[model samples]
Target chain A: MWRCLLLLCFATSAAAGKPDPQRQRELRSLLKNDCGACHGLTRKGGLGPPLLPEALAGKSDAELLRTIQEGRPGTAMPPWKPFVDADETLWLIEELLRKQPVSMEHGG
Target chain B: MIEINKSIDKSVPLLLLLLYLLGNVCLAELRGSGDLGVVIERERGSVLIIETSKRSILARVEKLGDLSHASVVFSRDQRYAYVFGRDGGLSKIDLLQDKLVRRVVQAGNSIGGAISQDGRFIAVANYQPGGVKIFTSDTLELVADIPAVYGDDKRSRVVGLVDAPGRQFVYSLFDAGEIWLLDMRDPSRIEIQKFSDIGRQPYDALLTPDGRYYLAGLFGESGLALLDLWHPEEGVKRILPEYGKDDEKLPVYKMPHMEGWSVTGNLAFVPAVGLHQVLVIDMLQWRLVKSIPVAGQPVFVMARPDGRQIWVNFAFPDNQQVQVIDVEDLSVSRTLQPGKGVLHMEFTPRGEEVWISVRDDNQILVYDTRSFQEMARLPAVSPSGIFFTSRAAKTGL
Candidate 1:
């Protein structure tokens, strides 16, 4: 069920491709600075659950997307729907799924 | 040729002794570390050793790993700071020399740590493996490990690890809704007093100024779990349990920090969970006296050293602004816009000045606590958590 939906979303997103470069940078910043506040900088988990590739290995795209949009109730995680749209949240999930989350960490 | 070589070797030792003594005399500058502090450069995995009096960054000590959620507690001597990193890296920095004295990766992931009353043992609260590990303050060697085992094969992440008087460590178990008191008077013999069913999801906590009460802010509910260290036998009491229960709760973007100088005199100011107000509690009765509205969700609602002013920094969407509350009338005295991403605020030892960390601007702004004027500005790289050496003398910093 989730597997089939994951395939469809991945196929569609692969064609749609990643967000623009500027939005990509903004999303990455939000991931490290905002999301990283609870989730560890390395995405190993702190106040929130870990977002490492290994942690989210089996989850489907829809489940992950809903969690980002609506957030998990009874936890510190908040819904980012006001700040980000569905498309941007999907790109963030991909960014976390990509190789080396810390590599994208930009410093001043 | 052999006799000449032997003579040169003997002379080398004598020459090195002279250079060693001379190097110590010239390089060792006699300066007190009482006014010094450190600002965490989160993105760069580094920290800046800052001097409060001059408002200058003395040195940038780099290569500290995973400082995304880093916290620091000073040694009793104020010469060293034990920084607990998100990656579970415990770094001891030498303030005088402005360098990383030693770095040790003790756990998989940790939030913060505390030093024992004697300053001999450093206890770290771990999140990943879920436990508390105590180490020798001087050598950073493992002395004791107590896992937060709440249920069958279930480990809870430890938060609010604070050292109280009588050489005891009080901390909260986040997942289990429990608080444990670890007695470390004798490092060999371990004793723990567990307070079960205290509250739900204690995100963070702080020990009071007099080191009497340990308050744990509840994220699962709208109350704070208070444990009086002087009378632990009485059990934990829930204070302000129903605050904002009927009110609308906005989605909390960032967790409110329960640790800091949030208490002063007869009153304590706490950030309401997911509400734009600061809950004022009377320390005498442990009751809610007033609820002062604020600009946004408060993160660090800290009081000045003199107890005259309360400075607050907000979380997420309104993170750019900081509001000051005049303690006399209990009102928002002034609001200052210190650029974007105002991460943290720290008062100097004397309360004459306060340092604010603006992350997006990459600048630390110092303001006069009395006049509310920007005194000085210094450059930093995405700074957070400005901790001063004065905390070394206080309990539960």
Candidate 2:
């Protein structure tokens, strides 16, 4: 049931529609916990980078999608398409771009 | 009489030219091998082909979904080229016809292959499935499948495959630190011998020329383990270290499982991927002999057939080139800048040219052996392993 909802949220994000706000928050929490370990919050710069407004501000949607899906050239970032679905990637990018910075010490 | 003498002189020059033409014809025999090096781009869903000799686009076979790796084996006559895509796409290219003759879909994404001693069969290690699939070299037909007895469906990966002298072939499964010995004397039936538990991630394995023992590099252990093929039960474990294990003079150095061994079987050259040195191990003594300092992350070390020099690919972030190491003196000889993101590379059949598969720009860069100069650049993109065929050397690929 949770997997289906996650899939639905991803589908809506990819189709360029407003996803469920409650589900979006849940998805945001997941990305913050899982992806932030390496890529960091907002994709700025950590072991990877902050995936947020300032870093991804002027980039094209295609560029963001390609980098996220196919992987950036000459880095450890592998092709995420096989691991993460397209719609979920869209939601993850959205979450990355919009999330506010949290304290680095304890918790978000 | 004067007119007759002038005519005779004119006929003399003509007769000499005729003789030269006849000699040329006799010397130009039809039976000669011409190896046409082919560069294949290993990308998702599509693979591009480029003929390196003339810098021309050959073919772009598409719809092979998410092709991660490929191995090409040319027929002895060089008439046909067999391409095995890791995503399970097997294609047969007729060099003379210049088109894909047949394709068999449904092999999984794979990393390495072991061609038969007689070059009749190729056993491919499928990464996702954690198994090795065997196919007939001539027909591209599925012959056998051997699944990983120890690998997990979600986490495990297979990297390298080496054919043992007998009916058995050794496979190194990734992350598991286990080498599985598989027997393929009969394609319809297969036997499995699980041995060599060295450490995590055995990168590549190869048999010595004498075919007595097998040497595999352990990624997690930062060493190469020499195992006796004759006694799998005994399991001989010998580690070749980057620095001398007990030497107090040199600081302890541990390479991150990306080293390569030379073809001579006497030395194992470990390219310290994160360090600034190439570790040399004398295989006979099974000890670390010397550490030659290098510039960047030397990921791959490929030895030439002559066994005099070792070609090391220093794949730093965006810094694309390969380094040549003189094995005799253990020194850095020269470095050849191949081009952007040289993900994988393979040498030509005669070792005359080195073909580099640069994934970023999606092209294979060629270099001349004798001059050590960029001979030409053929546009073949996103390629992992380069392949070649000699079938129509008269009309290059």
Candidate 3:
């Protein structure tokens, strides 16, 4: 029963999305090699929004591409007319929107 | 410009110097000066207001989504106010007209924001794909978008945002042990400083009046973390533990819910959920000096400007009243039963009264702090965050 309780705690924590070592590396790479040039990989955010999952969760693929293609009329998020092909941008947006594990561990 | 003719008097040379300085001061005073009021987000569809005082609501002009939620902020001089909308919409609300005259659709999400101390720029924290977008408060144009990576975990949110003096604005990512500060002096781009070694599940943070330290409240960590602004690389300089004792030793609430520092800049208070108490910390030493026990999962704690009392809102079991705490003695002063669903409280600048947002009851309860008496309850529609402007600084019925 004690083992079961421990397992239960672990399961809940994991479900809440504690950072996984493998996932972090993959996210960092995707952001750096792929999205970094435009959106910026590190502290320096650029023309595009950061690829953090919390920001992309509810945003739809079409909306993301629409923002890229049409460009916001009032702001500087210019239409990515010649920057990149539409399909490639769509694929990148999908990956950016994917949810990662929750990080609820009290490391302190 | 009027030219002042000063005759040279060799005998009273010192008096002439004083007159010259006085003339310059008078010329400077001729320039119009006004009080800066807190700009608040009013969830009235596409419309938001620049509230100068408690009762006065100035409609800000801006092009916004009919369904968009926007956060409004005013320049220090009360000349300009910026409105940030979710999904990259930005608008400038001109204070003089009390209307939003310029709109920038793709600026960034209007989730969290801080106005520059100089009132030249406004920084907004976009919720999705967390990033900070800086805009010129005067022109209402997109200056820069700094990619701000939040919690490694997805549930963490970039909720609380504030601009530290100088040009840097700090973004507090909830449930994440990190905060990102970006310099926005240059409108063309953004400069970033990622401080990831902060306490767990950091919520809101505020700088001391002297601007020496930035204190942040952490959830689940049971402590408040202090960061030295001069050295961002130093990480958390001090950790003040929050207090709570579970009589049953059974797990109920997860951690500390919401915390607020007093306007007096002396005490830091946290609502210890499930523990039924509010933790008080001395701001200077960063120590948990006392604990004032209270009823049921206390969700929110708010300090009046005088710093004498703290109003706490209990969440679970749906208690209708907000618990009061006396700062001097650190004891439970009185239990106030205002209305159902008393979740959040916003006080006027004078600290004369507090307006409590009762969600389910759909009303904002106005109360007198001195008598602990309920004054008048204004009907509201799903009020979550209650804010008052400098114009509406008095407790009204």
Candidate 4:
């Protein structure tokens, strides 16, 4: 019975595009700090291409996910697979698609 | 008849007083002098002129090319500002006239630049073609171009370009892992000194306030390479050996900026990349004495000009906060949440006030250093770096 429950938990998390609140928060920080370095803090373009919703409107979710995992060749953008997993990459794409601002907290 | 003449005399004086006040307002607008500074509008490719005394915005000049990573160095007279844009455009603007005097695209892509000690030449470090270009400060004309060649490749991104004493410029090459000194006292005959294999990847470097030592941060390794600029023949040596060697390396969200690293008295505060700590170094021994852990990954570890306290800001999840470290104890005295996206900070010349740029909030907040109380708030458009003309008189600014 314990094994069955454990399998069910794993299956649920393995589902594609499943939303996890804890993972979402971590991904938001990554997008705001890591990606935001080149892509402006406000998601406007900087040294790299802009990641705004309007800019990503034409690109599909699969395309965006692939780029995040594999990165663009011959550019400053490096593959983020080492840091973020596949599911988290999708979550980041959806966050970018929705144009959600990273909710920041006060000082620790 | 006597009453009508008295009324006319009073009305004439009132009209003259109004005219005099209007003239004074126009004159102040035209003069454009006083304690002045600039805020780099990163995405908009513009700079906003600010009156430091009034804590107000004077004007915004646009059309500075790809300013995603722009920096400015003022002329000796402090009347002109030389802006180095990321797209390799160097523009000289007259602050009094509020106009661009001259602009030239000198390279394919550039990072930051510095003005010579004599203020006669401006040197820009290029990333695309991988070299350093020197231009006449007055004309923006190319005086020398030295390619950062390593092995067989003729291109290596040059970073950490700073002007030193004796009409010389020193910089580090990222791809080549080298530090070079270029002497341009005689533009007709330039002298170059190359110190190769300084480290793995020197992302940024800074010179001491007294112009004695030049320290380069190695991104590809655990330690930093230091060069004694006063005695160039001694060569480069690694300091703080084995730093971060015992810990698992975390993904670096953004590179720690050595330009903002501060040295006060006998200690230097260095922001360690991928770590939530600021390494306090004993300058005399050139060794890491302690690591003060903070909120998150540290970006800029700037010291107050008075050398009493150090201010620190972080990256990503912790970027909204700023911390004050008391220099005497090497401990955090206070933590401040200035605003969202706290990008950069600059202090007044005398360390009376600190101006912080909140990019997401689009506001520049000035606080009294002693009380940490908000003194003024000026609207800005995604401001990043705040600079003052007072930096013009200081070395290694």
Each model's DockQ score: 0.49, 0.04, 0.02, 0.12
Best by TM-score: 1
Among all windows of ten consecutive residues in candidate 2 chain B, which has the lowest summed lDDT?
A: B248-257
Error of 4 at B193 (Å): 0.5
Write model 4 residue lDDT over B264-290, tens digit each, in one string. Answer: 998889888668899998889999989
Off by over 4 Å in 2: A1-108, B1-34, B44-63, B151-155, B209-213, B230-236, B241-261, B361-363, B390-397
lDDT of 1: 0.89
What DockQ class does candidate 2 belong to? incorrect
| Candidate 1 lDDT tens digits, B230-280 | 999999999988788898789998998988888889898999989999988
Better candidate by DockQ, 2 or 3: 2
RMSD (Cα, Å) of model 4: 7.4
Model 2 CA lDDT for position B137: 76
Report the C-alpha lDDT of model 3 over B1-397, residue by residue, as the tens digit: 1233343344368887889999998876332214323222223323434232343333433334421233455566556555555545666655555565777665334454667766677677665556566777777676776655544435334645766656666666664667776666664556777776676666556555445566666654556667777787787654655244234321222222342434345677766534666767776666777767787656667778777887777743445778788877888888877766465676766678777766556666778889877777655543445444342212110
lDDT (10s digit) by residue, model 2, range B161-196: 766666567767666777777777775677777764
Ranking of all candidate structures by their lDDT, best first: 1, 4, 2, 3
TM-scores for every candidate against the unseen true structure: 0.92, 0.64, 0.61, 0.80
Give the C-alpha lDDT of model 4. Answer: 0.81
Candidate fnat values, all: 0.71, 0.00, 0.00, 0.11
Native-to-model Cα distance after best TM-score fit, residue B169 in candidate 4, in Å: 0.8
